[model samples]
Target: MTEFNDKQIDILQAAEKLFAEDGYDGTSIRTIAKEASVNIAMISYYFGSKEKLLEALIIHRTSGMKIQLENIFKEDLLPIEKVERLIDLYISRINKNKCMYQILHFELSTKKRIMDMNAFKDVKYENLQAFTKIIKEGQELGHFRKDVNITLIPPTIMGTLVHFQMNKPFFEPVLGIKTEEEYENYIKNELTAHIKQTIKALLVHEN
Candidate 1:
């Protein structure tokens, strides 16, 4: 695997930051060229276009996760460990750049026709497969309830963690949290712990 040259990395990083801050429609190749300190023709030469560059960023970020989750699901780990680690990686990935999450969330609802689902379909399906497969295996091993809807639970877990920030502010005042950083890490850790506890309760046989 060859390395990304300084110029290539700069364009990539600039694309992620600008695309996140400005949204897809508002971002342009010239702006990225300016932000990256590269000529517009150079970006076109390396990455084709701004749209392709954005797709590359999402793919790059999620690819590591796809590989990690695949490894975890293949191991002989316990059910609760599987669930906990899944949530852990998911949150840690988000924590790396919370702003990117906002960019992605917006893209899904507003730019679907242009962005289409294919840009991220694999990542979504890969995660759903990992969680549902784990749930099924756990059920067979008497860790999870056989009657539980594994598919529903997996997506529900995703929806909850992803949207927790959106709901955090409304509930934060009643709970009296301080700065945004405090609220973010608090939710990240709490969400992981809560998911662990919930899965623990779902276990039919405790070891």
Candidate 2:
């Protein structure tokens, strides 16, 4: 993953916050400039336009995750252990970048037809292929059931994590949590444990 300079990082952070607060259509170059505390020309100079800025943010955040998952999949560990580690990686990444995920969830849900989702789709496809390779290796090694669908596993894992994040208003109160930090901790530990257990069961269960 390429390291972003402090100024670029500042712009991406500001864009993420604004995109979360206002839909992409509602956010503007001027707003981002103001929030980032940089002039409008700087944003244009860093990223050509609002659409491109969104793409850059998504790429920057997801690149590290892709590398981490690829490394985990390549680790000389048991298939089952690798699966557990993959779950941990997903939860940790999503929890750390809640804002980015929020933007993703919102964009797909509300602006699917209009927004340029090509970059996002490409990244998602690449990650899914990497994950499928891991699952296939496990099946070949007799660690996972042959009947398990590779395609469904990624959505199963991601959906569960994204659900907890997007439904915070509903879940935080249900879980009886009051602060964001507490909720993050619960997701990182308790929720992560549950997801790992569920995935392991699905992978190893007998027909």
Candidate 3:
């Protein structure tokens, strides 16, 4: 069995949990080391610094998700099926990295502190190209309406799926829902239905 030293595993797990709860500026290397039960200096020895560790965590999570999406969209599927699969992938990835997603999203929504170029230094081009390819295929196959702008669709679709995670607590207060499981079911039904109908309105033709 592949084994990680307790200190190493502890650092990673501690960083992930802390970063999830407290965003980049709010989390500290000392706090992480303390949480991990390791020397504060050991964080630098292991990961160089707080920022590098955060960067590595993002890269690790995104790369795994990128590979999965690339494989999922490889086959030329039907229009509705493709939409369903895309939402399914987003929902699945969000569930897998709920904490990391929260941290990354905080950075995204903030007006003043979005990620700088250095933050995404190791990002894969294939991740972006895959989404572009999917849209291009839909256009080529005449599944997506010719009038609909391909460039605009993907980002809108991403925003729609992200809404569940981004505005979660607000949803409970506004809609009077309880429990994460109930909230997830609400998102599944609501977002899937919204995506299906919105895509139909945008791209599908029915007489």
The top-ranked prediction according to TM-score is 2
Q: What is the per-residue lDDT of model 3 for residues 40-104, given as tens digits with 9 covering 90 to 100?
A: 88889877877667766666566655566677677667755766676677666766777876777
Q: In every candidate, how many clashes are there? A: 0, 0, 0
Worst 10 residues of 2 by lDDT: 110-119
lDDT of 2 by residue, 30-113 (tens): 999999999999998888888888878988787656677789888999988988888887777777787898887776777654
TM-score of model number 2: 0.88
By lDDT, highest first, what's the ranking?
Answer: 2, 1, 3
- Superposed on all Cα atoms, the candidates' RMSDs to the truth, in angstroms, are 3.2, 2.3, 3.9
True-structure lDDT of candidate 2:
0.83
Clashing pairs in 2: none
| Estimated TM-score for each candidate | 0.81, 0.88, 0.77
Best by lDDT: 2
Pairs in clash, predicted candidate 3:
none
| Stretches of candidate 1 exceeding 4 Å from the true structure | 1-6, 74-76, 199-207
lDDT (Cα, 0-100) at 36 in candidate 1: 94
Superposed model 2: Cα runs more than 4 Å off: 1-4
